[model samples]
Target: MKFSSIIYVLLVFSFLTMTALSIYYYLQIQQDKVKISQAVSSGTPLPDYHFALIGEELDHDYWRLVGKGAKQNETEYDVFVEYEGPERSNPEEQLKLLDKAIKKKVDGIIVQALNDEFTPLIDLAVGKGIPVITIDTDSPDSLRSAYIGTDNYAAGQLAGKALIEDTGGEAVVGIVTGRFNNTHHSLRVEGFRDVIEQEAGIDIVAIEESNIDRIGAEEKAHNMLTEHKEITALYGTSALDGTGISEAAESLDRQDLYVITFDTLEENLRLLEKGKVDALVEQQPWKMGHQSVKIMTDLINEKQVKKIHHTNSSIVRKQNLPYRQDLRGGRQ
Candidate 1:
């Protein structure tokens, strides 16, 4: 063959090989782009549907915060959020709301599980193919999809540790919880007991249930303080009960008693500033609300999520109260 002809043939061969490789790479990139688009658009193969969120009490600040989070999710995800609950924390009323949600055929339901007695109703919702996620409180026996809230037991333990640290673990303590049978309250009591039991010289002399009513909590606190004069500390598990305890302590001039409570209501913050309550355990109610709706959205879409999602709780003492206010914007 001539040298020029040989060189021309080699050049043609190299050009064809490079063109083939380029086409192969382009097709591979196109396929990968399609796969990515499907993953982003389809989102876990679950049904696309609306959700209903039922709380024990919708009028309360905490539940309102939860509703706000759900509303934000609804706007962001283009899903409907039906938020309904009783004016007060009534188990029967909350159950009726749950029934209404089920009848409305929402894709998922979120509840606070007013009390453990709502398990049967929760099971019914699950039986109807509507996934239920409990927030704040839960009924363990219920057929719920998941629970998103703070670890009440651990919160109680944190309060206990704070108390022990403040009093050198030898103070006589009293407890004021919202409802005796409520899961959150019960778990907190258990956690407090566990911590106090492990410590030396710290004793929980009296445990009282306030039913989460301010008047009821006040009465209980008054009676308990009158009866247990040696009590050096008081721990209240609920927002209302915490305020009541603080008020009772202030009224009776029990400045010696160290008060540790939960939630950061406006009044609670005032109490903290006034040196009436030594510390408050703050939970991320806003995050709980946001996550609850997100979980419901995922569940409706058949997306797998963690069975239990826990948010952290922090001890807000007088020293750190200002910092906490800056972080959470001085609101509950």
Candidate 2:
């Protein structure tokens, strides 16, 4: 009996020793990761933290605003935000950059999760102990740290409400959205549909996808107008959709057709000023960018942060254009 008790005590001590060693090594590994993140490069000290901001496209004006917003606080926060994306809106290319960012072991990642396929990469990043924040578009099913952008459904609802109020609830509606698979675009379309379905006078004549470019949007919008002559009001659920719709409307001699579009890009704002677009469902891409860096900084500092942060969304019209502040810097 005495021998058995002694053996049991010895085994317990050994187990505790192993546990302590494991914890020590784990802590040392974590410290090493921090050191790696802070390493000097080319004899210049690195920022306190390094973050990557990947968006849908590099050349897009709306995305440029997002990048501007993301880099707004680099100096203030003593952090560096590396912003890059594909020249065009390509999910595969975007995800490839995301995977590369993960492999590079960035301190944090802020990205636009284009579709459901982004889930695995986001989860992979989290699994590797790197934090991720979804910007503009979100992967709700993934273990993302937070999402910062418009409440897509609510923004769509706003568009529908604007259309109802502006057109006296008697619009023959047609939609040209960014993409069918993009969660935000789908939510926007769904919200618009739900609202339109409730109104008896409004009937949706046709719906199309823009593929998120001016040319595609123009083609889709032109085709919709030609095929569905009854389409009195056109809603474009992407940034360039409005511009395309405007050009399409003018080309078809349908300038009087009510047009609504997403975002307040320079082109959209120009169209709005000229009365080409009836209303703009404006999203704060700059704000989305700005808040992401702030949130990521907080996250890196071990601060508790909100899981979801919506920037802002509003309807801009010709009447209110004069009263609106200069969005040149997207300061608001």
Candidate 3:
């Protein structure tokens, strides 16, 4: 063959080879892009999952709000929320609930721990590849993923500020708490004491524990009031105790005493309306329950969740009582 013709044939062969390779590479890239788009659109790579919550109690309005939030999230995310706890707040019951959830192979667990008894159970859940998150009350020593609840310290501070304002910064205060060891009540008492100590003319005359029970709170409040006749104010760290304190005050006809408590329970709201409890610090139990499930879902899906979520509390008095009817259930 002539040299020029042979060179032209070689050049054509090279051009065809290069064009074929380019087309193959472009098609491969397009295929990869499609796969990624499908994965993103359908969340195909996400794990199938559900979560369970072992709340402190089921019959209480506070826990009901939490369960409502969990159910709302469950519906939104197309996941199951298995909620079960004791009729009353019992650490042993909570542990049994934890065991049941683990046996069911839930994707994750959310706990409203009654006490430190659930620590080992929480650790066991984590060891078995299940993530556990604490809400409302936490077990700090456990291997839980995170805590989602109000800053109890700050809530107490708000309570103290309210008390100070109501009493014009001068009064002997009596404190009613549910449990001495419960983290929420303990932090609240600490914060309240710290703030009250900072202010002049404010003194904590007595601190009483009601075990978060109404009758116990009532008895404790009566004793405190009878013993400390100079007490000018009362503060309760739990919803039940708050109502009990109010009842005790009403029974004594001590209309001059200022009462401040926590949560928006019906009885407490009624007392607020009657000017029995001057102010109540309200926590977002619904938000706690909802966000807890969300965090658990994220953990199960291998997605990121905030290490800590703090829900703020607000002071509810008669002035703002009407607007929060849904939250207070028209208790006032």
Q: What's the lDDT for candidate 3?
A: 0.84
Per-residue error at 35 for model 2, in Å?
Answer: 18
Candidate 1 local distance difference test against the native: 0.82
RMSD of every candidate to native, in Å, equals 22.8, 11.7, 21.0
Better of 1 and 3 by lDDT: 3
lDDT of 2 at 113: 93
- Write candidate 3's Cα lDDT for 219-247 as tens digits: 99999999999999999999998888878
lDDT of each: 0.82, 0.89, 0.84
| lDDT head-to-head 1 vs 2, winner | 2
lDDT of 2 by residue, 1-332 (tens): 69999999999999999897567556644765666566653355667888989999999888888898878888889887889899999999888778877877889999999898999999999999899999999899999999999999999999999999999999899999999998999999999999989999999989899999899999999999999998899999997898889999999999679999998877788888899999999889988999999999898889999999987799999888778867545665
Off by over 4 Å in 2: 1-44
- Which is the leading candidate under TM-score? 2
- For candidate 1, the TM-score is 0.82
Model 3 alpha-carbon drift over 4 Å, by segment: 1-47, 329-332
Ranking by lDDT: 2, 3, 1
Clashes of each: 1, 2, 0
lDDT of 1 at 198: 91
